[model samples]
Target: MTDTPTTLVTATGDSAGKTAITVALARLAADQDSSVGYMKPKGTRLQSNVGKTLDQDPMLAREVLGLDAEMHQMEPVVYSPTFVEGAIRGTEDSEALRNRIREEYDDIAADHDQVFVEGGGSWTTGGVVDLTDVDVAELLNANVVLVAEYGSPNDLDDVLAAADAFGDRLAGVVFNKVSDDAFESLDQDGIPFLESKGVTVFGALPYEKELAGVTVGELADELGAELLTDASTDAFVERFLVGAMGGDEALRYFRRARDAAVITGGDRADVQTAALD
Candidate 1:
């Protein structure tokens, strides 16, 4: 900690991959000889292992960023049972939670070179974290990195709203899962759209399935279904293309794929049949 401040990585919209981007950025800093500190300050909907809720992502960050402190200290609050319980009753106090989050953030931030603080969910989804990216950014008094999804009609609005909410604390935006077609959609309207709203498009990413992490078997577990093939266990895909192509197109790409997992919800007979085929 240099008595300055740390960087807070945030996202404006859903499925923006804030965690992945934050981890990647921290890894970048570590690569450049900076001892990076990472945190996902708030999170809900944890992955469960029997009675224990696994804090896998943060643990991974601790390993990758090479932290020496207690893992739980990095993330002081787990917005699982408590957050959901309050949210269900519609009695969750956003500002109060913000204060607690900030206090915890300040503590960890005091010792690290660059602490990367990530948010819980998108602007709309919140259980207990009391933070959208904007709220967290404001409370932390740190720079923001808004994760944006390309090809969405409301991307501009969401991104701008987050920046405006954070004001001077807002840094820039990184666009996630940006496909070639998505970029084409934004081609003419892209620069004007961002400039019109006073925002910067930091980086546009190609869709990577590994980031999603909801593998076939994992989806099977979540959906209460059995894996049809052993491939579901080991098939970690980097991306998924659904109806983007025709007969030859599907085979053309899938034929070259090795250990690609097929992830879809339960009772989607159409997808189940397709995967089986």
Candidate 2:
């Protein structure tokens, strides 16, 4: 086991902003003059680059942190469809993959003061290959910082479950994308409740539209919609409003939103014009 401290930032569920938290923590460490390194041992979001399959999150981390390590060292296992199928068919060598992840982690740990390992969509992800977030944390002897999106007070149950799953290795839990109303309640009530249960609450981050929004390009890709205009696709859309109301009401609704997208039919010229306006 490496003496260097490592953190595994995982989420309670899908779209819980694990990557965001990991990146934020890495940036904070870097700002404090600490040599920070990042990794995603079992990557599910795969992208092809230079004839090699790579994980997108690690690539973003590598660029953001200005890390000198190569992509292979940052993401040792690309959990693509083929890789999963191999695991299912017993064609993939699980031990070999685990070894590769450890070797890569050691390589990164050797050069940095701290290493941040981002997990997959959820805590239980990668069970087929025996490399769930908890599994990796145990493999690297890492402290786990589980990120969760706050929906209600009941979400604390999930945190407790994670604490049980991670046991003493759980460093803390962070509530992300919390709404304005939920923020005060979580800060006052939720934090104390979890702390009473011996679970540390790192923070309850209020929801920020800019941070939660999806890029227009990503939205288009997910919806399979072709762009008809030359609008900048990089722009983010935090909310989606249907243009079923009158033009004036639609305009009023649009004005209230920070970064939003309007969904309407082509024949509704009034709504379309209002949206454009």
Candidate 3:
């Protein structure tokens, strides 16, 4: 905690607009003409190019925050697999490792007025990874905002599970990528169902292209995404699809890329096939 007394923002429950929330919060806070700062406390799976491992996501905040801050400060750890699970699984005494992590957290917490810390992935999605988002939030002393991806009525259980995860520090959760019909159902059944569990619904954002779309200017502004093809800054984009579809017919889709910006998520087999080609 710095002398400024910053409020830490941690969102973990399915990637669920975590990055978007980070950007939007910064955008909204900046719009208010306030001096707020951003940080991702931790990171995973950094990309290396030309012997340089780059922290892409946090770079977006640096550009938006208008701060000359380096990526190292925004994202403290950039390595394979998230650090939480990594620490929990090892025989290396969780208490000692936890202390080290907290030390790293306090070091950055000492910097800004209000630091927005984005949590990694979901809290409950566990496999061999034992430590979850709850651990991260608890260690960091941050409040939790769970974003429910279950847009339909049948997903009430999902919402309940998230509330249960947040426990005492549960601030307010939002339902994202909601459909029109689903939103209707959510208004009646879903919202009441969530309310019954004592969780407040903040705001539900529809699945919009703008969230994913990157105008060349926005792309350039975003230090995370690189523009393969050069274009004017004034150019705007419609939608960005990660993982280009494989097959000749699918490639033909790109022929109509006038207003579309294809953003393929690599490591996806279909994307690797189509995007690599």
Candidate 4:
């Protein structure tokens, strides 16, 4: 492993905003005049680009961070169906894969003062290939920064469990997508409680609806939907509603929504008209 400081941004559960935290940390480091690099050792979300299969998160991070490393080095192992099947069938060589990831990471570390590695789904992800977030952190000799999304008090259990899993390698935890009440509770009670247990609470971020929103084009792409109107596809959609009720009811529901898309049958022109109205 290299002497350059490396940090693995992992999560307590799925969709825990690992990429967002990684990007944010990298940007912060860059703003401090530090050379920052990024990587996602095992990519779970696959997307095809120009006949090449790649992980979508790392691709977006590279563009957002403006890193010069090639995409292949940033995401070394993609957990495609074939790769998973081979691992299950005991046909893939785990050691060789690990070596490749290390080599790529070393290359990145050679030129940068800090390298931020974003973990797949969660800490236990990639167990099939023996490349979980914990495993990758140990392999790279990197410290862990676990990101957890707070829904209730029960979520603290997940953070404690992850702290146990990472041991001293875990630097701290960041609570993301927290509600107003939850944020106050965490600040007043939760942070002290976790610190008493030897787990550091870095920060609790308040929930921002706009940050969680998706563009209309992304929604259409996810649903394989066709746009029938000339409206801007770049508009951000914060939520969605179903227009299955009467025209008045649908209109009332639609009116209450902010930047939301309505889903209904194509034959129901009344519902469509209500949504439009």
Model 4 Cα shift for residue 234 (angstroms): 13
Off by over 4 Å in 3: 1-15, 30-34, 48-52, 79-97, 125-131, 214-277
The list of candidate 1 runs beyond 4 A from truth reads 49-52, 87-99, 127-129, 152-154, 208-277
Query: Highest lDDT: which candidate?
Result: 4
The TM-score between candidate 1 and the true structure equals 0.69
List the RMSD of every prediction in angstroms.
Answer: 7.9, 7.3, 6.8, 6.0
Model 2 per-residue lDDT tens digits across residues 1-20? 58899999998998788888
TM-score for each predicted model, relative to the true structure: 0.69, 0.77, 0.66, 0.79
Q: 50-109 in candidate 1: lDDT tens per residue?
A: 233545667777787778766566665566765567667877766776666666666677
- Highest-scoring model, TM-score: 4
The superposed Cα distance between candidate 4 and the true structure at residue 73, in angstroms, equals: 0.4
lDDT of each prediction vs. the true structure?
0.67, 0.88, 0.61, 0.89
Full ranking by TM-score: 4, 2, 1, 3
User: Looking at model 3, which ten-residue stretch has the lowest summed lDDT?
Assistant: 123-132
Candidate 2 versus the native: TM-score?
A: 0.77
Q: What is the number of backbone collisions in each predicted candidate, taken in the order shown?
A: 1, 0, 4, 0
Local lDDT at 261 for model 3: 57
